[model samples]
Target chain A: GAGVSQSPSNKVTEKGKDVELRCDPISGHTALYWYRQRLGQGLEFLIYFQGNSAPDKSGLPSDRFSAERTGESVSTLTIQRTQQEDSAVYLCASSLTGAAANNQPQHFGDGTRLSIL
Target chain B: LAKTTQPISMDSYEGQEVNITCSHNNIATNDYITWYQQFPSQGPRFIIQGYKTKVTNEVASLFIPADRKSSTLSLPRVSLSDTAVYYCLVGVGLNDYKLSFGAGTTVTVRA
Candidate 1:
């Protein structure tokens, strides 16, 4: 089966600019998540979307970071007024279902490496 | 979410088995243990997951004792390609779906 797909494998932008990263979850996957990984650091959870439920934005570092998922298809993580600290690989993942209790492992996309100057 | 602890790194040779253990002393009854592998410039890939006892897949094996405070991921006869970062995560079914990943153990396989 095809895996989750992320666009703009690499993106370099100036500070204060806005950047949008895209993710295409696997077919039939009802849950999607976004994460950030700084160099030499573990992944930091960003946001999650489960079916029709309200997206979990608790992990968003600041108001500048936001994500939206349309139905169950695609998700876009937008960083407004990007800062140097926002430079990192943005990863997206999806599972067959949400609620984690079911033990469905998330499948991940390679991710988008964002660089801010 | 339960916090997990794992080694910083491990060194091994091709054909040798590698075992990375993770500790989650505060694991909840509903929490499950899962492992992920990531290569350079790639996203983490699920290796194996288990709630208790032992679970084995074509890629790796997960061993959890009755206490469930800790779990071990065993990769049998690893090859050079097995060199990657192995993350041990505990905390599923919380409906949060946000996995708290600590610095994973970097396994370097040398021929």
Candidate 2:
């Protein structure tokens, strides 16, 4: 409960279906990030939100992938018309400060494991 | 963003000191090096971070040489529970939010 919390730890869906993964960051963290980790691979950054500033969505793979953060409390990553390649562990992390501060480390949640069939 | 390279895997025994090295030849002046560990089904957990010189925390030690071109993550008296995938990331203060985490090194601690 103290750490970052993610919902629906596991989800299985059809290839054409849509799914939303939620993340609740630490109480006062101002920076939030979303990442995707495929099996036997490294994490791929999806999006980043720093306070109320515009989100950095450069890492988004396509138009179908989008994310949003409500202030600094909760964030959600959505995938529309998901494909089999969309299957992976969606991770959420939060930091006290944005990436501009190198010393601040990001705390991560266990993540939501999504399987697209 | 600087590119980082680490070993594919390593094997160590309990009570031994495991040192995993990462190379970042084109690191920038403002880039900081950070390490994270991940278990089978969990997100990465921060291990340690350093800009230059050496930094030590309860979980691990991060050693960065003067050139800042390479870093080593040292785990002392490692136990079987230390077995996991370790990632070395090279960017944080470069104003680049999308930090790259190349395929990490898998360290297996044996009894």
On lDDT, the leading prediction is 1
Candidate 1 residue-wise lDDT, A17-107, digit = tens:
9999999999999988899999988789888888745457788999998888887788899999999999999999999988654588888
Give the TM-score, chain B only, in order for the candidates: 0.96, 0.95
Write the residue-wise lDDT of candidate 1 on B46-99 in tens digits: 899999999999999999999999999999999999999999888766674777
Clashing pairs in 1: A100-B93, A101-B93
lDDT of 2 by residue, B5-107 (tens): 9999999999999999999999988788889998889888889989999999998899999999999999999999999989998877637666566779999
Per-residue lDDT value at B96 in model 1: 43
Residue B29 in candidate 2, Cα distance off native in Å: 1.6
Give interface RMSD, per candidate.
1.7, 1.7
Task: Give the best candidate by TM-score.
Answer: 1
Error of 1 at A31 (Å): 0.9
Once superposed on the true structure, which residue ranges of model 2 sit more than 4 Å away at CA?
A: none
lDDT at residue A16 of model 1 (Cα atoms): 100
Give the distance in Å from residue A101's predicted Cα in candidate 1 to where it truly belongs. 2.7
